[model samples]
Target: MMVKPLATNRSSSGMSTGKLAVWWLIASEIVIFGGVLASYLMFRLGHPEWGAAASHTNTWAGALNTMVLLTSSLSAVLAHQAAEQGDGKKAARFLYFTVLGALMFLVIKSFEWTHEIGLGFTLQSGGFWSFYYLAAGIHAAHVIAGAIIMIWVAAYAKRNEELQRVEYIGIYWHFVDIVWIFLFPLLYIAK
Candidate 1:
């Protein structure tokens, strides 16, 4: 008996199936974040006092994390480039750098949060604190998830298997960074 080979489905939109799926995931994330941000903006406008609470946020820490994430994004882009060139080891190295950046960002965030909580800026402190925790917490979770995924991709990249995944992971990392870009300004610089 002969078996038929499975066929790959091409995207009608001219995108790779993997890339298209990533875009769809990002679109959904945008809606979730947009709703939260819109609600925060509405409440912030109605309760101007929220600005006073926001002022207490560590601007320096936020700025540092911004730089870290941006650097990580550059590494992710480089990983994709290396993967395209079929340099699996080089691609894996870049991915490791990206993961390191994520760790640095998380560390800075934890310190900032600890200081704020010590100063009585707990979630139950007020509406502003609640929103602050919710938004940043979700973003951190994404960062953690991205780092783990990158690590997995890096392992495969080193073996030259599934190299296309490097690009997909890069796309996801960029989205994560962009989210932080919006969040840093809103949470730390808006005051």
Candidate 2:
């Protein structure tokens, strides 16, 4: 006898269980990220002198990462399209490209952080620097987590199993990219 999870077999909602679960997770993540960003905004507005610390952020590196994330999002879109057409291999291939973009973004972020740290921009440097590291560090953690999950999803997709997961991870990846769109301007351009 074979048994599957009850959620897999039952769907009272119009959405698939996988989709609903992903959305639920995303909603929780939104609450967390929203709180952090909102707090940072309040702090930034209260202390104009923090602009000095903001000036230290690497706009070029941020811009480059923005492009990488956006491009990776495009690959995610393509992966979803392939999965919809029942081409799991193609979907997995696109997912791999998307992961490559994630790795590239992380590498650039590391170099930028190394340079800033070398120049004495530690988390304790100032109020703005503190929020900068907190917000950006959280975002970077999400990027790393997303990439790891994406790799696992891609492995299943390559085997033509759990193809619908392609869309779920794409949703999460887009959210990650959108966060960067917000962070890039706030962290890199507000100076």
Candidate 3:
């Protein structure tokens, strides 16, 4: 009997493998972040006094980071557009801008955290501080991860190789931005 070949690489859902994989990854991330945020909300409602701690957060810093992430998202979109136009160098330059935004975000976050910690708002301070750190720390990790991936994608973008990956990275970067959108108000402005 002749051995049958594996099915076509395309999923039965009609989505390309890369796109489907990114969606799946995003879905999983949503569930994780959603659960965490929901838990934080429940705790927040129970402990209204936490607002005092939340108020200690630097609104300016959080707002600045929000703008940075939103701007970086625009860069990611432009990079994807450039890739579609077959302009690898342009795409790489835009990706570099996105990465720079990510760096700026982390730098600002580091300063904020340092200031907070120096003021005695640390992980062991209280529930509000703990949640604040937990949420922001996780988000920062995502930012770093996205920046690293963008660097890799930009390298290939410069070479005009794996152009499709540029779009995939864009999707992930946008999702990261959306997560921060949810987080900023919850952690910084809710008070």
Point to the candidate with the largest TM-score. Answer: 2
TM-score of 2: 0.97
Which predicted model would earn the best lDDT?
Answer: 2
Model 1 spans > 4 angstroms off: 1-9
How well does each candidate superpose onto the true structure, as a TM-score?
A: 0.94, 0.97, 0.94
CA RMSD per model (angstroms): 2.3, 1.0, 3.6
Overall local distance difference test of candidate 1: 0.93
Better of 1 and 2 by TM-score: 2
- Model 3 lDDT per residue over 116-174, tens place: 99999999999999888988888889999999999999999999987888999999999
* Residue pairs in collision within model 2: none
| Overall lDDT per candidate, in order of appearance | 0.93, 0.93, 0.92
Q: 162, model 3: CA deviation in Å?
A: 0.3
Q: What is the C-alpha lDDT profile of model 1 across 1-191, one tens digit per residue?
A: 95533323465778778888889999999998888888888888899889999999989999999999999999999999999999999999999999999999999999999999999899999999999999999899999999999999999999997888999999999999999999888999988
* Prediction 1 TM-score vs. true: 0.94
lDDT of 2 by residue, 29-122 (tens): 8999899889999999999998888888889999999999999999999999999999999999999999999999999989999999999999
Give lDDT for model 2.
0.93
